[model samples]
Target: MRIAVFIKKTTFHKGYGGIETQNKSLCEGLTKRGHEVFVFSPKLELDRNSIVENGVRYIFVSCAFKMDGFFGERNKDNWFTRSAQRFEEEHAKQPFDVVIGQSSAAVGVIKRKWELNIKVVSVAHGTIISEYKTFLNNMVGLREWIKIVSNTGYVLKSFFSRQREYVHGSEKVVAVSNFVKSALVDETFVDAQKVEVIHNGVDGGARPIQAHPNNQPLKLVYIGRLERSKGLQNLLKAISRLNNVTLSVIGDGPYLPQLARLVKSLHLSERLIFVGRVAPEKIPEILSQANVFVYPSLRYEGFPMAVVEAMFCGLPVIASNIGGISDALENGTTGYLVKSGIIADLRDTIREFVNKPDLIRKMGDAAYAKAQREFNLDTMLSKYEKILEDVVK
Candidate 1:
């Protein structure tokens, strides 16, 4: 089968984010399995608007309209109309059997569907529904916020309207998790039959690391952007309450300095180490080196790829019990789930894990087993393949 995979950005093994990394894996996996794959992403990293990676061709296109209105943050316009035109020019050479758009690339995908007559499958990262109602509340009662706030509403409205159109225009809509499915169905009013849940897969495998082997400090790792919504402050507060647990934070974002100051103010400078950003390929090694992985995000995340990567590395995970995390971690069995934003509960969970070191082994083993059985990369790619096959047939 020939498939056209669409995402907003693409990077090599090093600079890519979760979605990009997953798209890369899916593209590579699909190609290796005898299917032809083409990746359509922004040409931000490319000099010639295209590059071929691992036998699959990547077509980068610019967006005409500024996505700031679409995504609620101002970003450089990507000549999307030009990109769609380029795609049309290329489609004449070789047509794709199916088109798969990840996240909110519905507009571009819809345009592609009109040109190609191929089935379009939208993989929603998370729809703006009841869970995002909080954002709406934040936008109200502010002057000059009218434009951006209106745009935010416009974006959500467009999301629902386009999603409905895409659902009717294409073959299927894949929600990243059941939590996302609920958001689409109840919050967005998407037909349940049109949506399917396909959890993101972890890339590499993780093995249990032996702690206390040579008197090394217990290493705890948190990977991903250092945003307030991700609960880094809560982790710092919880770490200040605990003893002997050293935290190593990988990744950087707007809130890095703020998080650093919080650690200092809490006198946790010695316990918390912020490593800033690192390469994606190095993440597994970092995970293997750590004793536990903490993801205390307070936001309604779709599903964190970091938590799954930690599980694959066999690190005992402690995370917020929100969205699909409960489905991912299997709380008390695979990993510990603390109440969202509860610093005390986070501290208590850390203390429990520290005191009962044996629980780490049990949960780590469970996590590894779960990763091996349920979240294998090949299995995820295959599931996608089956769906595309059905859609095309």
Candidate 2:
């Protein structure tokens, strides 16, 4: 099958995000299965217009405006839509069996469905409405507040207009989690029948279980963008209350300075270590060195890839009990889930693991087992393949 994947930007162009990771994973997976997968993205510093890597082909489209920034909101000239049209025209001889569009890319694909003459599947990672609300609630200052307020209009317009077309306009909709599926159907009025829940998967079976010595300090790791909604501040607050535990933050974002200030004010400079933006390949090694994985996100997540990656690396997770996180972890089995924003509860959960260090190894074993059984990469790829094939038929 010839598949065209439309994403605003990808890891190919130094775009780092869960959506980009998923897009790359899906494309590579399909390519491995002997399907010809073509990924379309805005032009970047590529050596050529197109490049084939890991059995998949990447096509870079040159547009008048660069659709950079989060959610590609900086694209005031509809660069993605224009790029899609150009891709269609350039590849006019070869028709795609199906076009898989991720989030914002879906809007452009839906707009050109008639011209492309292909089945379109819009993959919804999360809802814009929920994200807008999260940003509004987490606004730090007047600048952030004004920015969110301005973007709120676009989000509202997308929710009422483009979002509906993106959801209803596609042949089928792929929701990364049950939480995402519910949000699409309940919030956007997308047909529940058209929405399919497919949890994101990760490559497993790499590292063997490493022992966490009882005499050593409790090693806690949080791997994600250091944003306000990620609850890193809440994690810092909870950790400050604890005694012997140490946290290794393995990502970078705008909120790093604020978090650093909070650490200083709380006098937790010694307990916290920020290893900003480690390469993806080095994550397992980093996770192997830790005993517990903490993801204290306050917002609704569409199946956090970091949590699953941690689970795959044989570390038990202590994440907030919200969104798709609940689906990823079975409380008391794989790991514990604390109530969002409840500092006492989070602190207590950390203490539970700290006091009973043996439970950490036990939960880590269970987490690895769960990750192998449920979140295997091949399983996710096969499901996606079937969906794409079925959609086209």
TM-score leader? 2
TM-score of each: 0.89, 0.93
State how far residue 147 of model 2 sits from its true place (Å). Answer: 2.0
Show model 2 residue runs off by greater than 4 Å.
44-48, 64-77, 205-211
Off by over 4 Å in 1: 12-16, 68-80, 111-115, 130-151, 211-216
Compared with the true structure, the alpha-carbon lDDT of candidate 1 equals 0.76
lDDT for each candidate structure: 0.76, 0.84
Identify the leading candidate in terms of lDDT: 2
Please report how far candidate 1 places residue 14 from its true position, in Å.
Answer: 11
Cα lDDT tens digits, model 1, 45-127, are: 45676778887898877554344445532333544455555666767788878888876554555755765676778887676
Residue lDDT tens for model 2, 65-168: 44323455446446656666766774687877888888757566677678677688888999887787677767787889668756876777777766787898
